[model samples]
Target: GYHELRHRRVYDRIWIEYHLIFSDDTSLQTSHDISHRIEDQVDHLFRKDEVIITAHLEPESHEPQFASTRDEHERSPLPSREVGP
Candidate 1:
């Protein structure tokens, strides 16, 4: 039962991101509906067309896992992008 939420304002526009925790057995449809309702409620409460919200649904029983490859990827530098030849 944990959640992380963050919000920021850019030129009078509100941007919000958060994660919603649900039981691992919860159906995808239910989780989607919940996220939709939250988005709607936040939009209505803010009463601003510029308000943007992002909600990530996650399982409450999630097991944190770490892999050496993942750690290496994080530490590795990004590949350079070649522009015009």
Candidate 2:
């Protein structure tokens, strides 16, 4: 799971700060790649007017113990649901 630390509109652009939380079993390379993918997706969605100031990757163990107890549904890599008008 990822936490959004900060987000704001600055002039003609948007700035964001993100904290990427991963399980301790995840590798550094995988975390890095995920962050890059997040950044790229945000960039693509916002075009040139958005900036991801930081994407800090940290292990779930470093967070409060309760955070690690999220339900299986919350831990899914990507959950899908139908979109209705």
Candidate 3:
């Protein structure tokens, strides 16, 4: 399952973040596949060149918490990729 963590505009580009929580039994490959599909959908919904998506994958048992401040969020360790042309 997944949840949209936040969305904000940085300059002229839009940034969207999501938390993709998976059960302990879920495989890494499966998680990557799901995240990619989500990225695709988001790309299709918005102007590809103007949107950036940051997806974080977490184990279901882990506590669901977000950065306490925007500065922290910007420095998050999660991998982020630009998703459009």
Among the numbered candidates, top TM-score falls to: 2
TM-score of each: 0.67, 0.73, 0.65
lDDT of 1 by residue, 1-85 (tens): 2245788988869998877666678899998886776676677666745898888877755623322233433321213332221
Badly placed stretches (over 4 Å) of model 1 are 63-85
- Candidate 2: tens digits of C-alpha lDDT, residues 1-85: 7665688987768887877788889999998997776666666656658565678888888875537554531442323332222
| Residue range with the least summed lDDT across 10 consecutive positions in model 1 | 76-85
Q: How close is candidate 2 to the true structure, as a TM-score?
A: 0.73
In order, the Cα lDDT scores of the candidates are 0.62, 0.68, 0.68
Question: What are the per-residue Cα lDDT tens digits for candidate 3 across 1-85?
Answer: 5556798887768889878777667799998897787777676667635889999997766734532232344432334454555
RMSD of candidates 1 onward, in order: 15.1, 5.3, 9.6
Q: Which pairs of residues have clashing backbones in candidate 2? A: none
Ranking by lDDT: 3, 2, 1
Q: Each candidate: how many clashes?
A: 0, 0, 0
Name the 10 consecutive residues with the lowest summed lDDT in model 3.
Answer: 67-76
